[model samples]
Target chain A: MTLVTVDDVRGAATRIASDVIRTPLLPCARLSDELGLRVLIKPESLQNTGSFKVRGALNTLLTWKENGTLPEGVVGFSAGNHAAAVAFAGQRLGVKAIIAMPHDAVESKVINVRRYGGEIVPTDDLLGTTEELASRYGYPPLLPFNLPEVIAGQGTVGLEIAEDAPEAAAVIVPVGGGGLISGIGAAVTALAPSMRVIGVEPEISNALSLAMTHGEVRELPRAERTIADGLAAPRAGNHTLENALAYVDEMAVVSENAIGEAWADLADSAKLIVEPAAAVGLAALRTGAVSLPAGCTVVLVVSGGNADLVKLAQARMG
Target chain B: MTLVTVDDVRGAATRIASDVIRTPLLPCARLSDELGLRVLIKPESLQNTGSFKVRGALNTLLTWKENGTLPEGVVGFSAGNHAAAVAFAGQRLGVKAIIAMPHDAVESKVINVRRYGGEIVPTDDLLGTTEELASRYGYPPLLPFNLPEVIAGQGTVGLEIAEDAPEAAAVIVPVGGGGLISGIGAAVTALAPSMRVIGVEPEISNALSLAMTHGEVRELPRAERTIADGLAAPRAGNHTLENALAYVDEMAVVSENAIGEAWADLADSAKLIVEPAAAVGLAALRTGAVSLPAGCTVVLVVSGGNADLVKLAQARMG
Candidate 1:
């Protein structure tokens, strides 16, 4: 398996520069005081489509257009943010997008995909339905995370962090299908080799953590449902796993309760509204699942903010 | 009243440059599309102390230090943000801060004040209690919005906006005691005279709106308590009113429901977590209380993000 390179990540950054926000690196003063480590928040939650998925989606679609292979339409499968991003990119480029979402995908995410004008098909078999649609309708498939192009796209986050928070000793990212952290791992490990890259997942959705332990990607039995819905990918992308093996330094898993507590704390103290999946890195750090030394500056990538208000309210109630 | 000038704002910007985040101006793709106008977001909610009050607080104390008149301690009355900011500024500058906060101030905000090392005195009469403390202890009063230094500091936001979103035709700011808008009015009006300055207040805390109608600073009987706790000031400072009359182009009052709706929409679409006071600017625009021409570019200042999660949950349940 060919791992993605920093140059490819740089290219994606140039390609998608105009489309995505150079989301800020905010100083987490409260957390810094509490943890005795300087914590900087790299909030990709503020990115276009409210997630880092926009970077990859835009990069892939923009690459296709650049190659003059832009299809009339595309079909993709995602739990949420990626599908919405694909839809948004399709709309931006005047291409049709049909997305297959999990039958039980969060309502806000489904709404987000539809808001971008992506035709949504609910299915229990997310990948199978998307594949069938692509084959039947003659639309090109934009597989979410498995592609090198997507990996390269997401690596831009690392490039930005390297530029914006160079003082950071480590970069922690949320891992779902490992698309985000894979790209971040590839970029950061190549460019800032001294800075360790850590991936965080909910204990229930610890695919990347388990893969790191076993030295290979294995499809595990579906884990119990997690509040961190975005990290529930039971298996990592094949390309992502390869990239992870090459670049990622460590992985950690935090409990559902920790994730929930982190989510609320982030909003209350940090004034950051982030989705449950995006809160896992903070959860890991705050819960002692991934402890760093005092004075160690860490950059926590808040990967998305497409949070459901209802879920946010429920968290408050608890 | 001696109104603040753009140069004063510039000096404040330089003075507090290292102490605060130069918060980014975010592109609101969804809001821009829905409004058929370019809507950029200036999220001071991401500022130090999670509000723009830090700029004013930092500037006020910094100026005192620069002039060799730095006091032994400072007394201030605020709903929350300003008090917390004063506490933060005092901690940074090695001065004591005693804050008079409303008994009904949001719990999170109260926590913020305490966290910043400010000694809090809960009071029904915020200003009177603060004044009494200042007189008794010889701790100079750091009034929230009336001071030229504080207004000048907040005006730095306008300086950044003028530089960052030069295309904007209008700037919508949330008004409490008019300190923020007064400062912004001073900067934007001086730096970009063609741009209209609009102030938005909740109907329950329409001090500036009523002041504009009356052409003077007038204390209205206490209105109904607003969900926008930060914008619940019943009167504007005399200096702030004078600046508003001179530099502010218009004032609008929005219903509490509109503020709540706008807060949720900001979280949902723009992925911005803002307090209800901050949401009123968007609420005014969304509710047609401050309508702009189609294709007009407008900048909305999300003034702070010290939101109560319980309130957020309640908004979601609605």
Candidate 2:
């Protein structure tokens, strides 16, 4: 099995350097004081397209373009962030993109995908629609998380974290379909072998956590309602599970209420307005679900900020 | 009259390089497309203490520390951002600080000021109370916007803007007591003479605008209500007026409604959660209060993000 190596991530960094933001690793003074640990946040929420997904999407598209196998059009399915990323990458690379987003995805996310010149196909079954569209038009499918190239691209974030916070004792990342963490886990283990890589997921969608516990990929019986819609993936991919089993240190699950509270706390204390998905790592820490030794440095990867303003407003009110 | 020079701003940049954030200059894709102009945003909202005020405060404190005249304590009065800056600077410099904020200032600002180890003194007359306390304790008063050192420090933002967006044809900045614009106006004029430096003010608190119109320092009859609480200063300072007269090309006023709308739009499209005060420059553009030639590049200085989450949530709901 050829897995994503640190060298692959390094290549991805070089490939996507011009396309992605080298997001700042900011010190969370308020959170640090509260946690008695040096708390730093990698605000990927500030990345172009408002998520780290852009890194993977751009790298994949760039690779395709370089190989001269770039299709006339690309198709992808996403809850939101990945769709916008594919759209943005497609626009920049001059490739037509068709994004199949969940019918209930956030309006802003849908709007942004379209704003980037990607045709949006709202569907109840996003995966089925994307596959159908890809087959019908003979367009290449840009997988959101499972592909090795995508994972390698996302691992560039871990390279940044390792460089920016070399003394980091623990790095907390929110897990969705597990691409982000799998990449980060591989990179951090290779570069900063002593540091622990922790993955956080909403309690309602603990696919990665359950997979780790069972020592195999596991699927949820059904999709569960979660405030962190970004982390609502039903199962972890085989590649992600294999990587996580080898490199990831631990997994934590946070309640929906905790995710909402963490979202608001991040907004108030850190002055960062991020989606519930992005706040899950912070939620794990805030709710005491994940604990680090005193005086240790922890880096929380704030995954994205593409949240509905109305919902965020309602969350703040609540 | 001696004014802040580009040299002074360069020195400030060097002095505060380790203390303040070298905030990113991001492109506003949607706004630029809307106006058919290249629109960039200098997100000082992402600076230390969530505002550009930290640059000035850190520079002042560093100067004081170097001169060996650093007071045992510092005192300052501000609606919010400046107070937080002073408090953060004081804490970093090992100087005790007492900050007097308006009794009705945003709770988050008050809490942040306190969090930085500054003693908070809530008062109806913040200026009077700050002055009284400073005199009583022999603590030096760190004026929010009138000090030469502060303005010179804030000028560093202009240096960054000039460097990052060298092609910028116009720069729009929000003005309160006018220190920010005065500094930016001076720096931009020196560094990029062809760039038009424009100041934006809320219609209800158009102190700088009125001062510019009268060709002298002027005071508003009363501070009128506006969503941009950060720009609610009743008058422009003498030093700021002098600098503005020398350097600023034009002043614009934005309605309260427009400020609120711009604030929401920034959150939605740019994924940046900033105060209405920070949104005023964008508001000026959005409302057609300030117009630039087609295809010209415009840089908007987003001054701060220390807004009440409750109010922001409410604004998003509306």
Which one wins on TM-score?
Answer: 1
Worst 10 residues of 2 chain B by lDDT: B264-273
Looking at model 1, the pairs that clash are: none
Q: Residue B166 deviation, candidate 1, in Å?
A: 2.3
CAPRI verdict on model 1?
A: medium
Candidate 2 lDDT over B190-307, as tens digits, reads: 9899999999999889888788778777768965567788888878888888898888999899898999988977766666778899998888887889989999999989998887
In lDDT terms, which candidate is top? 1
CA lDDT, candidate 2, residue B193: 92
Error of 1 at A273 (Å): 1.6
lDDT per residue (tens digit) for residues B1-318 in model 1: 577888999999999999888988888888888888888899898888889999999999999999999999999998899999999999999999999998889987998899889999999998789889999999999988889999999999999999887778999999998999999998898778889999998888788767777888788786689888898887887889888888999988999899898887776667766788888878887889999999998999999988877667568667
Best by DockQ: 1
Give the C-alpha miss distance for residue A222 in model 1, angstroms. 2.6
Task: Name the runs in model 2 displaced over 4 angstroms.
Answer: A94-96, A192-195, B14-18, B93-96, B117-123, B131-140, B162-167, B192-195, B293-297
For every model shown, what is its TM-score relative to the native structure? 0.95, 0.91
